[model samples]
Target: MLASFDIGALGHSFWALTISGLTYGSIYALVAVGYTLVYGVLRLINFAHSEIFMLGMFGQYAALMMFGFAPQGDAYDMGVAQTLMYLGLAMIGGMVVSGAAAVGLERVAYRPLRRRGAPALVFLITAIGASFVLQEFVHFVLPKLTNNTLGGLNAQQPIRLVSPSTQFTIFGATVTNVDIAIVVSALALAFATDRFINGTKFGRGIRSVAQDPVTATLMGVSRERVIMLTFLIGGVLAGAAALLYTLRVPNGIIYNGGFILGIKAFCAAVLGGIGNLRGALLGGLLLGVMEMYGQTVFGNEWRDVVAFVVLVLVLMFRPTGILGESLGRARA
Candidate 1:
């Protein structure tokens, strides 16, 4: 087992792995933000959040289909201008669907429990059950709803929007347009989210509720409103991540596609500090980079193992995570 490990691969492809890792890390960071945000406000794990991500994938694909772009083996050859327009539209479509679904999930699955003063364990179980319900809906119901055009047992044929082309080289690693786009878009969204959370009045409300729900309620902060906003924001970001993810892996939009990725994102949230926004970002990038390195050294098959092991080791040493800060304690 020791001899099978190839440490030299990391030395040879350090830059390559780093760039690739950052690209994936960006996606993970976006999805992990949702996990962190929901946990911060509700202290709920939101296991069904991954299913929301999956729906966003399908939502964006449907948007493309509505635009007359059929699923095919190759990407559309439209000019950069048209491609950007369609991509923007697709992103919007995903965001809307995901945002609405998130709100609905809160209303249908969680709000009733909240009214009943359900235990934390009940909420967690509901989240898991909701996740299965969403997945199965897509697996069985979506096909019938869409006349078999959208979701089923297999991955939808890829509808590529931007074909990757090498744009530059860093050290010895090549960077593509897709890599640049994913990283830049993710950073922009994250920055915007941070600013909104820290600077806006609504954001203050969220923080207040998170820090002390009873006090925040006494201060006239509507807990329900804050919770809804949290879910919306998280869902929108997940939708954006879904688009970026599809750009990187076009054929990844299956009914159960979000399962592993969602788990990784949750691990990222825990790794960084579950309720901390900045921590989620940091944890995701670190997880992505480390996972890439582990895959390189151990083999592709070890990728998932590497991610889980990192989570376990982190939990063993620092249960509160790397940052060990809660969202309520975050500085403005």
Candidate 2:
């Protein structure tokens, strides 16, 4: 194992891997926010959140189709302005679909349970079941609904809006336009979310509910409204991330595509402190960088192993996570 370790490879590709890692980390951070927000408010893991991400992929694809951009073997040659307009439209479609689905999920699957005072275990099981149901619906039912024009066992033929071309070079790493777009867009969204959470009346309500729901309700905060808002915000972010992810990996929009990525996002939430927003971002970047480096040094097969190993170590030594701050108690 020592002989097989390729420290030199890591050394040579350090900057390239870092850029790649940060790009992926941005996506992970966005998805992880969904997990953290739900956990902070409801104390539920929301195992189905990943499926939300998956649905967002299809949502964006559908949006592109609506704009007369059909799935094809190669990217269309739409000029810069037209491409941006369609991309923005697709993102909006994704956000709307994902946000609606998340709200509906809460209404259909969770609200009744909440009313019945279901146990945490029951919620967990339901979340897992919901995950499978969503996956199979796309796998089996979506094709039927669309007359096999979309959603089946195979990945959607990619509708590449942006072909990654080298835009700049930094420290021997070539950065592509897609990389820049993904990172910058993710950061802007994250910053906006942070500001909204820490600087708005509804944010205060969310925090109050997370800290003490019974007291917050007594104080005139509508707990149900806060919960719905949390789900909506998280889902919208996931939808944005889904579009960015497709930009990076054009062929990644499959019915079950979000499973592994969703698990990684969940791990990111746990690694950064399950309820802490900033922690989720930090953990995702770190995890992405570490995974890239590990893949370089220990071979591609060890990439996932590194993420899990890091999670296990964190749990063993610092279960509270890196930041160790809960969302409710976090100061502005």
Best by lDDT: 1
Note the residue pairs that clash in candidate 2.
Answer: none
Residue-by-residue lDDT tens digits, candidate 2, 209-282? 99999999999999999999999999999999999999999899998999999999999989999989988888
Q: List the residue pairs that clash in candidate 1.
A: none
Task: State the C-alpha lDDT per candidate.
Answer: 0.93, 0.91
Candidates' TM-scores? 0.98, 0.98
* Reference-based lDDT, residue 55, model 2: 91
**What is candidate 1's lDDT per residue for 183-270, written digit by digit as tens?**
9999999999998999999999999998999999999999999999999999999999999999999999999999999999999999
Candidate 1 TM-score, true structure as reference: 0.98
Candidate 1 local Cα displacement, residue 279, angstroms: 0.4
User: Candidate 2: which stretches are off by over 4 Å?
Assistant: 1-3, 330-332
Models, CA RMSD each: 1.1, 1.2
Off by over 4 Å in 1: 1-3, 330-332
Q: Which lDDT value does model 2 have at 51? A: 93
